[model samples]
Target chain A: MGLTKSEIFSTEQNQLAQLLKALAHPARIAILQELMKSNTCICGDLVEELGLAQATISQHLKELKNAGLIQGTIEGVSVCYCINPSTWEMLEKETSGFFSSFKPAINCC
Target chain B: MGLTKSEIFSTEQNQLAQLLKALAHPARIAILQELMKSNTCICGDLVEELGLAQATISQHLKELKNAGLIQGTIEGVSVCYCINPSTWEMLEKETSGFFSSFKPAINCC
Candidate 1:
């Protein structure tokens, strides 16, 4: 999933899959939660909040950044990170479309 | 992500993350789309539909089934799979909760 074979699917499908893959980890989710709770750019505080090593948190942050889920700005020796609202909105719309596509007709178990 | 550190987060967060991880692949997404299109249990047709190797499709299907996103029934030489509606509903609710939790106030890039 690092680099998906996006040629195999529609752009919407590929984009949706890529975004979902980015959120597929607990560390990343925790990072996003931290950002949400703060409601502002967070810098160098995730390690203390999440109890993970700095390097581990950085890797998770990198993945989130790569997926365009979070944005960062340099501030002194630290990087301030926060959720990218536009991308988050796009994610919400695509995910809602995917999940709500199927109309549960009956218990077809 | 195969077996996440579930103890690190709340049960809801872990479950949602696990579900997203299972869906982190293009093949799995294609499989789900195929299931949705058919509106019934699908068996060996996926190998043909996705154009991936049979083994690859099998593995993807296994991941989806393991995540409770899809349910299968053994029938003769193959297994037929269909969406697990309850799990899908639960996933939708959890995902919506996570995304809608944030009230985007201003353009915070």
Candidate 2:
């Protein structure tokens, strides 16, 4: 496979792409929704909540953790996960900034 | 490769995933940022602005257009593109709702 070539872009562009890519999957979105709804640490509860395979849920959780969007803590044999508020806030700011930048042009389609 | 299996998710989940997937690539992100900054119709300016191949930029624009994030109009020899404000607003609402749902859990990591 070819390299990402992410260096060709600006740092902000790369950062934004990374954040969005982390959010580009349905399983991850479901995991996040479950986390938000619970508003509490989730320890292996995603398997039941999402009705997805344990390995699939674990993989999604790993992606979220790697993205720094969520944090996990070991609890016995299970790991409890929760949103990283700071990262969430940062994501909000970045996404809001991106989406709110456009103003309807006088004669745009 | 396996099928996407998007049917297992809720409508909201699928919609959000589609939008995020459309935004996941750096080329698409760059195109959006360029369009936002322009705040005017753009006709093939992305190739120069992004320093990417014409076909690459065109493909990225196709994804953005397919996601309804941008609208294109045919000019004499090129298609002019601009952000679709309504769709952008929808995206903002959906993404904001998702991210803002999390109130730090009482005893989360």
Chain A accuracy as TM-score for every candidate: 0.89, 0.93
Tell me the interface RMSD of model 1, in angstroms.
2.0
Off by over 4 Å in 2: A1-3
What value of lDDT does candidate 2 attain over all alpha carbons?
0.84
- Give candidate 1 regions above 4 Å deviation: A1-4, A107-109, B1-4, B107-109
Predicted complex 1: CAPRI docking category: medium
**lDDT per residue as tens, model 2, B1-107:** 35566878999998998999898877788888788777767768888877778877787888899999999988889888998888899999999888878788667
- Model 1, residue B33: what's the lDDT? 84
- The best candidate by TM-score is 2
Tens-digit lDDT string for candidate 1 (A1-109): 5455668777777888889999988878888887888876676899898867798889889989999998898878878888888899999998898888877645455
What is the C-alpha lDDT profile of model 2 across A23-101, one tens digit per residue? 9888899888888888668768889877778988888888998889999988888888889898899998999888877
Per-residue C-alpha lDDT of model 1 across residues B33-92, encoded as one tens digit per residue = 888888766789999987677977888888898999989988788787889899999999
In model 1, what are the clashing residue pairs, if there are any?
none
